[model samples]
Target chain A: MVSSFLSGLLGVWVIGVSTIDAFEFEDEVERLRYSGLIAEFRCPKCLNTNLSGSDAPVARDLRRTVYRLVDEGMTDDQVRRYLQARYGDFVLYDPPVRANTWILWFGPPFLLLAGILVLRRIGSRMTRVSLSDDERARLEVIRKQ
Target chain B: MKRAVFFAPFIGFIALVAILYAGFHLNDPSHLPSALVGQRFPGFELPELTSGKVLGHQTLLGEIRLVNVWATWCPTCLHEHTTLMDIRRATGLSIVGINYRDDGEKARRWLSLYGDPYDFTIVDANGDLGVELGVYGAPETFIVDADGIIRFRHVGDVNDGNWNREFLPILDSLTDG
Candidate 1:
């Protein structure tokens, strides 16, 4: 009797958690796409939060739009473009590489290359340090002592 | 070469400071640029705020106007209400309001109390139109040209300072040409 009651309670708990973001999807692939798209987009109101994570009204509306588009069999790229058209590239976490965004994409790798070059230059200087003849003689005398 | 190498770190530090300072002064981080600018305003069929009459995007076409997003819940909208009224009175410019994510009854009451400046307010209780317009919050205004294309968008209150500085130039150009 206790086991049966416990199982019933677990069922209720599972239902409760599942219904939190209770958008129903007939197809598993569509459901996954909906979830993926929401997680990918930034909430316009809540700057730091993704659509999946934000409870903002705008986020909720955007989520519904994404769900509707996915259900209608729109491709992921089309869905992204739809949002990008409305919200600009700011809605996407991964901004496309464009003239303005070139620095954002290439700046880090360029910095790494520059850092390596700088380190190599410093390393060469340290390794190629040569003692003068007087200093060498002094060092030899110190070694003999 | 050696002097250049020695001064590199200082030059880099100065460059970093200059970049940061420019970034700080150049743009307001909270203000997201609108993608709808220069594009036709998104099509929508929504009800009018007072009357139950359903309206479409065609209603707003053929005029240079200000489409202002507002809500009873947003305190800033209340602050901006008088400015909108002043604009309406001064220029007789067509101003349309989008009642975003708000109860119609309360919105109606608020407008009556505050004096409605909108020529015809679009009821967006569910914020569907707000989503289409990329509205993040209330008190955002869009300047739409006579051709129904959005010319510019201003986020936050349409105060006198910004009116003169940011919006006036655009408004003047749109009116003149």
Candidate 2:
């Protein structure tokens, strides 16, 4: 009963914290855009972490930059381009499809297809090797013995 | 078909291993390419290091120059100071400094003690301009052409080896052009 009551209290606290500290936005659409972009921008200082998830000093500064630019009525693409101009293409979690990245995009599916083909071949070969009638009779006699 | 399929996975695995080995051997993770390269330097208005006079990006234009991002707190800056002085004396190339995230008094004192090598140091106390320049660490040197396009950026201390081997060749090419 105590544990259940404590869990209920924790749930209420989490909800209150999340709801109360959501930065006030003049436009609801703008706030949504801010959250979306933060999740998309890579933290320059952290490996494989988005700006919204990082607590690095550079990440904090980048978040402020996003907020300032968004507040100034810059579109999402413009804000992205601004960061790209400084931090390079690496700052985008989803880099643009290009000649250099073609392998990264197509490699997994190709590998999967190859794997399936290999598995199918092996499965067929295993089925094709079903024991001959004499071999099967010998196995049955062995089991009886 | 069965034989080919059996061999395919091994061939593919070998190929993948070779590719992974080449990538790990060739690529340096610490050296990230700067988007600002081949682009114009970002504009900023910063106070000159001891002087109260304000300077902007325009002040750096009209000459082939080196803009070095440095700070009093960074020990690497001390190591690169003599090298910067040598470059200034040897090439007579304009070397501008960006004093990043430092107290004005401390920066001035640091320079005073070290024998200032910069043509003019811009005080970037808040590092706002450093952010604009995409500087993550101190002692990053940028080579800007007369047109103000950034040609090269050196991220670490500019010792004799880099100065002679890396920087000089590029400086010669830019100047020749």
Candidate 3:
């Protein structure tokens, strides 16, 4: 339990370092305000990039919309949920598990399971036999040492 | 299909990692682009919007300058115009605009209604100029140093808050020398 709590705090610190405040405004001159809000939580379809402007025009437009919403006072999570309401769970950058993202939610264990099953099936078989006198003597010597 | 399903979870894990890798690749949401940040500016010759005369890369050197990528068709650009005007007024920063993919009449009208804060405006009707500058959208902007290296890039409208918060400090840091 203590380990879990420590790690949770660590997670917050990590986010603090990685992401700047999405909505803090200073003056009215520079662009890129609220730029980090949405794409940080939104997913892209195929590109290696975030839902950020990638080669996909749609992704770029969605990011622009996110900037607009964040500037209009939507929190990062609120903007993500808004996309969820409109486009379902897949639109989320860090998507929640659902009927659609079953693959994402259950994928790791399934892989581990398959690996475990394959390993168990192919692993060295358990064999039972009375120990030979020589092996017993070797064990006795090792134990004594 | 069941085989695919049987392997789906592992594939999904691998794919998720790939997806995450890609997302982080674009993680900054274009606070900066992949190239040209802190790099020397590429050279270009553009016809001056007002005079139909050519201006080249050399003209941009020797001062802190702003390269604003904007369009009359973009309402967000309109939203940012006032903030940009205020910045221009305060700093006397050499301001330039790319009339991106826009008609001259509309560009002229936009400047009229919104007030042009730019010292130089160039026609980029086909976005060729924008392509060179790595512009992905209408309201993108960049801050270039006197050495012609790009110091900053903003991928959306510059509003009041961003001006006070991010830009001023960055510009101050850049110009402090």
Candidate 4:
């Protein structure tokens, strides 16, 4: 079946495909061929919940661009990288962040640290007395008796 | 010091907006762009595959119409075609079909084999129109009313409950007035 499908696809390609890049297949084949890839590629703008075109404009354009690249024999990662370079890392749903993306990479953790400091200050002011006399007595009993 | 005073609230609001926007993006479509219920229908223009003439989108003035995106090769589309025919016979609403990324001959054959309930079938062979309409997959159905507004859009196969349990009755209610 796979061989037959490949052969049939080859036959179809002979007519529609021109110089690899100049060729255009039947529309359904184009959409189906890319659907396998497009569905998995989450739209960076809409995040993970929506794939590259859940009625979102940016998602739609990305889907079109991804399909065009895939049809041109580019792997999914290659297509992703091309989009990343052109549109910045924001275009990729999950972009690898290193030295180049220190701001986006470390922003959340930095905010968390600030939040911890704020919470600590608030906690300090709200609750004052440390160890009560009764608590001291209990500790002394645990330590001695 | 002068700049900080004016920029304080503005910066805070900007941060809040960014976080909120990111959060919304992270959330489901049930939250983002969820105004199909009350707003105008999504208007789209797609040329026919063979003739290249435009189709549908104008008929959706105020009454509910089923806008289904389909193609010959999609198996899921075959499953829903029968359901669509049943809806056409029972409800009598305008059903517009967007033939996404398919050849003309195959599309005609697919319809000839099972049935064709589409009031108007738009051919979007290159996905340009599909891109414009924000179509990601085949067998997506949008409920548009006569006022050229989208009522609902269901991705994937349309189950029996989608019509018998949910949409049909809602469409029935809309047509009441």
TM-score of the A chain in candidate 1: the value is 0.78
Higher-scoring candidate on TM-score, 2 or 3: 2
lDDT tens per residue, model 3, A1-145: 9988986786575344333334344433222334454445444334345564344544544555665676677666676665554334444456566685686678667778877865554453334346899999999999999
CAPRI level of candidate 2: acceptable
In candidate 1, list every pair of residues with a backbone clash: none
What are the clash counts of all predictions, listed in order?
A: 0, 0, 17, 16
Q: Which candidate is the best by DockQ?
A: 1
Model 3 bad stretches (over 4 Å): A1-145, B1-32
Q: Write the per-residue lDDT of candidate 2 for residues A22-139, one digit (tens) a residue.
A: 4556775676677778878887777678877776656766777777789899999999998888887788878888887777787667777888888997888888998989999999
The whole-model C-alpha lDDT of candidate 4 against the native structure comes to 0.65
Find the candidate with the highest lDDT and give its number: 1
| B28-147 per-residue lDDT for model 3 (tens digits) | 643433355787776788887777789998888898898898888888999889988988898788898888878888888888888889988988776656645655566988888999
The whole-model lDDT of each prediction reads 0.87, 0.82, 0.69, 0.65
Output the better candidate (1/4) by DockQ: 1
**TM-score of candidate 3 to 2 decimals:** 0.52
Model 1 spans > 4 angstroms off: A1-19, A131-135, A142-145, B6-10, B21-25
> Per-residue lDDT tens digits of candidate 2, residues B68-143?
9998788999989999988888888999999988889998898889888888999887767766877767789999
- What is candidate 4's DockQ? 0.04
lDDT tens digits, residue span B1-177, model 1: 966875565566577568768878888877898899998998999999999799999999889999999999999999999999999999999999999999999999999999999999999988889888989898899999988999999999999999889888999999899
